[model samples]
Target: MDDDIRRGDLVAEGEPEQEFNPGIAARLPRKTVAGGALVRDEAGRILFLEPTYKPTLDIPGGIAEYDESPYEACVREVQEEIGLALPIGPLLVVDWVPALGVWSDALAFVFDGGILDQPTIDRLVLDPSEARAHYFLTLEEAAPRLRPSMARRLARALQALTTSRPTYTDFGR
Candidate 1:
């Protein structure tokens, strides 16, 4: 390691980047971790869900349960919410969301679900308790229907698809 490399209290030329110090870890503030999948249609339109619990539309995803990875959580959510055991691709975006009202700060991720043809789209089974309807729309048409930060992060997710690399998106809102 270079002498310029530094992280937290333990600083040395050859020190590793991550160290397991329980004392320091226990004091770290916890942020909510969420993961979702961005599924597109053959026409390249995004699949959006009208969740019963909220007014605005959302994608297929949810908060990670204890001992669950972000990718696992996203897959579980897709099955639970949309009743599809579809394949989940690589991560596209990770965003930092500020606390609003009663919610704490959060780290959210978006994964690529690849393009779904019409037949597969027709097979989606929505859980009435989670979502009422699903639709496919262009990002421009979907933007106004989502939270500003979400819209921005989603746009970044779409862009990252072309570069084939994960994007870190922060709206700072």
Candidate 2:
């Protein structure tokens, strides 16, 4: 992984240049693991959440606490974020986002989850600081709505589910 790190720019004679690189500092291992379900409703729409600060939509999951397991974190996050009770099962994807400088390594475990029969749309609650709104979309509709990285990740996950193939991972795990 250290090989992935590289120098940013060159310094002129007798001049010191400020270094700017994605991997300049030692990358810390992720302490907080998270998971989310790429759920499709009966109407064939995928569930998504619009974050309060971020312009793009995302799956419902966040950082896991030190004592919490990934599955527990998933269940808790879904309930806290959308007021839904879901049973999480199986691991889907474990991704790393090196560009997020602060929390550089994020282990995202996507799962096949159980959905509630009744919709909790009206009763949905949002953490004012975390989310703004929520919506559902079909693959055809969502492709254009997501940011480039999100779109690619979703596409890859969906393709893996469709083809029963394993996904590529940057981390050794």
Candidate 3:
């Protein structure tokens, strides 16, 4: 099992801590579920979507329907956002947030997706209600521009995928 730590838990540079605070935790509201994809192109660039209602860029995904699994939600989200059907691989990260009083228990599935051999990203068929544009970026190029949470999440996901070890972690809980 992965180590669990509370928000305020502190550790020295060389020490490892595993205990976590279970209290002060925000419970899930009916356990909201969602999924996203870490879609990479032939040139190793990752895809990101700029949300219409939000300034931060995000992965393409939406809440999963009651009958849908996380994987199913991911496939559906990609099709809805980009009008493309691509194969999804293993789960990379499962993130949890509680401070916002919102439980975005998300599963990120990695995939060898994106327009094949296309150097330029075409305009996306984004849902105006959800996103305004889509773009591709290398990890280094996108790091500085993404929200801190998104950048950290992506880094964790990429590490998990490369190491073949899936990770599940809670935040603000």
Candidate 4:
């Protein structure tokens, strides 16, 4: 087999090595993406979902599927997990979660879900299989229920709401 002979495969034998190799794509940074809704009730309490699959409490959201935008994923997850077709609002927080044990680094987004009325909260239809329960709590009250980074993210999201700007953070810190 000559080096110049064409053997069509993953890499062609006849092709000279180029500066930009196909392997560059694999070496490029690949980060996970997720979206969450910073839903709030009229009492200024944040809506936090107790996802059955998650060890700790999380907002109504999940990882973005292939071909789906983070906003779309957030909207879909909210409806699927909480049975609410609420119009998602502006992006509040874009948190860059650091890679943890057995977990890849991720870019997590938080969108404003605006304040829901009492009746709307009452009408929330949570699927027992997806979430065992839900809670509406102040940041102080909710911090204990979430992982430290998430608690920070939530706090930053709330701050973004007040400031009318989105925040970027390193693992929500």
Candidate 5:
């Protein structure tokens, strides 16, 4: 191999060298991305979903698919999980959840789902394949039933709602 021929560089034997930016292929921090919603009821209670596969309750959202944005994923997940097509609002919380050795670290975005009326809530059809049921509970009542990280994210997202600004947290702290 010629000294001019570096690894990852493409060239024909008699053709001029072609340049490629190595940085373009630089590795980025490995983190899974997820999106969630902070839906509320008319009486100021948060809505939670009980997934069939998880012990703890969860918000209505899921892992973003390839080429999907967090907001888009949030909307899709809400419809898929709860049959709600309500427009998702601005971001409320951007949380970085640390890995628990069982999975990769994740960056989660929780968007404001606005408020739902009793009729709308009653109309919700929970997708049994993904979730068993849904409940509207005050944060205090929800803490024990939710993942600790999720409880923290809820607190942060509520604060964001009150302040009308986005909040950031690490490991849901």
Candidate 6:
């Protein structure tokens, strides 16, 4: 309505100009995505990796890289952790873990690596830098060794394996 105003102008008088600020978006909470595989031996024991950097034992997986899908990351991580290049099966579990202290919330995925043959198990290799040792342990034996969160996730994952369906958990429960 004023002489200085131009036609088709989006801003109205007395209204603050608005712009999309990436800084504000960057401040929003982001969940880290990770993928791993649940592999088993002929005796029906799950395979666990003992990471060199962490005092805790972890599954055969790692954090997903930028622009990498969860499934792809699973395959890559499995190969990196233990020199295996087997095809990864369908996703079995998706666990949303809450933030604890300095760590951020994370969405972790588990894929079915299927049962390994005796020959494959015998040929398995472990990278000393990534994994110090690998073991095949029954569910009962592995429970106490795994962190509480991982234990719950493994339980749900085993249930998924039995039911032949995918399972989801919040905070590893």
Instruction: List the pairs of residues colliding in candidate 1.
Output: none
- Candidate 2 vs candidate 6, lDDT winner: 6
Prediction 2 TM-score vs. true: 0.67
Candidate 3 ranges beyond 4 A from true positions: 1-29, 101-116, 119-124
| lDDT of candidates 1 onward, in order | 0.87, 0.65, 0.67, 0.88, 0.89, 0.86
How well does model 5 score by local distance difference test?
0.89
Off by over 4 Å in 1: 1-27
Residue-level lDDT tens digits of model 3 in 91-140: 87777644453434443433324334463345346777777777778767
Better structure of 3 and 5 per TM-score: 5
Q: Can you write out model 6's per-residue Cα lDDT over 1-173, one digit (the tens) per residue?
A: 23245333535554655648847766888789999999999888999998998787788988988867788789888998888897888888999998888989999999998899989988888988899899999877988878789989988888898899998999678
Clashing pairs in 3: none
Writing each residue's lDDT as its tens digit, candidate 5 over 1-173 gives 23355333444545754547655444656678999999999999998999999899999999999867788889899999999898899999999988887888999999999999989998899999999989999999999998888899999999999899998999789
lDDT of 4 by residue, 44-159 (tens): 99898888887788889889998567898898899988898999999999999989998899999999988999989988999898899999989899777789999999989999
> Residue 154 in model 4: shift from native, Å?
0.7
Report how far off residue 124 is in candidate 1 (Å): 0.4
Q: Order of candidates by TM-score, top first?
A: 4, 6, 5, 1, 3, 2
Off-target runs (Cα >4 Å) in candidate 2 are 1-32, 114-124, 163-166, 170-173
Worst 10 residues of 3 by lDDT: 1-10
* C-alpha RMSD of candidate 3: 11.7
Worst 10 residues of 6 by lDDT: 1-10
In angstroms, give how far residue 94 of model 2 lies from its true place: 1.6
Whichever of 1 and 6 has more TM-score, that candidate is 6
**Native RMSD of candidate 1 (Å):** 7.4
> Against the hidden true structure, what lDDT does model 3 obtain?
0.67
Q: After superposition, how far is residue 172 of candidate 3 from its true place, in Å?
A: 10
How high is each candidate's TM-score? 0.83, 0.67, 0.68, 0.85, 0.84, 0.85
Q: Looking at model 4, report the run of 10 residues with the lowest lDDT sum.
A: 1-10
